[model samples]
Target: MAPLENLASGRGAFAPSSGEPASPSDGSGQSVGSGSSGRKRVPLGNSSAGGGSTSGNPAGDVGLGGSSGQPGNPDDPFILPQENASTLDKKLKVEVPMEIVVSCGPNGVVLHPGGYRISPGALKGKGAILAKELRSIVRLRQQVDPMIRPRPSIEFLVEPGGFDTYHEARRQTVISGLDWPVSLQVADTKVLDFFPGGRF
Candidate 1:
């Protein structure tokens, strides 16, 4: 039979009172730590000698084998693990220069440089024209293109209070139609002022 101290601390298997193996608990019918089963509850930190325990592997315990070797408090749920700065930088870096710009407002969808307007009604059918025009302008293939020099930086500005229900759909349509990199932003007058000619 296992010692009384071992049984109380849940260190050893349940000991039987008679020659037959004992059921989980004493005849009182109450389980350890309010468990329906008659087994005693083991502490979170301890592991059995053979590496078996009621709780899972001790390595994953709150603080022991976390990113840092410090012990984590099991009570605190909001703790955020530290992340590697270099990994974050690599994930956030932009790989390609933006080459498509779109400005959407209540007035209409306006293509930059030439300020071509596509009315809301015509947006469904004529939207592809904007992408085609931008491609031509970026490639410097247009006969009367204002941007004679091709620049790789392209940005899209969607004005606030514009294209209420159709905004996202129209924006995605323009994005999917373009072959080059594109950036989208929701800008007010103040942000637009930062553009070269105070136009976004």
Candidate 2:
């Protein structure tokens, strides 16, 4: 168990439901702060020798292990504990893999420039046409060109905070594109960040 997990028992570090957590001292020689970043962390040896209390690791999610998503709060999609994204999204019925790369204007889905031959700044065009296409792309996330093997990202400007209802999220999708099916807008994002449980 790493130092970041929040023990439901409130004793201390919790073993991630997933697997191992990340350790800050791996290279930096800087120890991970314990007890919610305020209290002192007992040395790993001492804690284990005494059969340890729970509040041992304080690195949070990272200490839990590899990032498996797990966003800061409910509004975000970081819930899972594994990073096998494509497969994970399918299990969650999320439709696609997307995240907020930038929380400001022009922050659209990033077509990861790998294996695929598509060009950036080119997928971009002038005015509403571009926005419309992007909006359309979002709508058709369930269906993608199988030939375009590269994984794609889908980003939606969440309601300043979060979607109040399923209907609201759907309605916002429509309204965001009111000007051109993909109008750019500002979204207030909550990025609290819990450590990934590793298997998400």
| Candidate 1 lDDT by residue in tens digits, 126-196 | 44655555666555532344334344545667787554313533454446554444465875544444446
- Count of clashing residue pairs in every prediction: 2, 25
How do the predictions measure up, each by TM-score? 0.33, 0.17
Question: lDDT for every model?
Answer: 0.54, 0.36
lDDT of 2 by residue, 40-153 (tens): 755562353333334453342442241333446544455555568776555555333432221222323332111122122433333433334444454454355432222334
Task: Single out the weakest 10-residue window by summed lDDT for candidate 2.
Answer: 111-120
Using lDDT as the measure, which candidate wins?
1
Off by over 4 Å in 1: 1-100, 139-153, 163-177, 188-200
Residue 25's lDDT in candidate 2: 42
State each model's C-alpha RMSD to the native. 19.6, 32.3
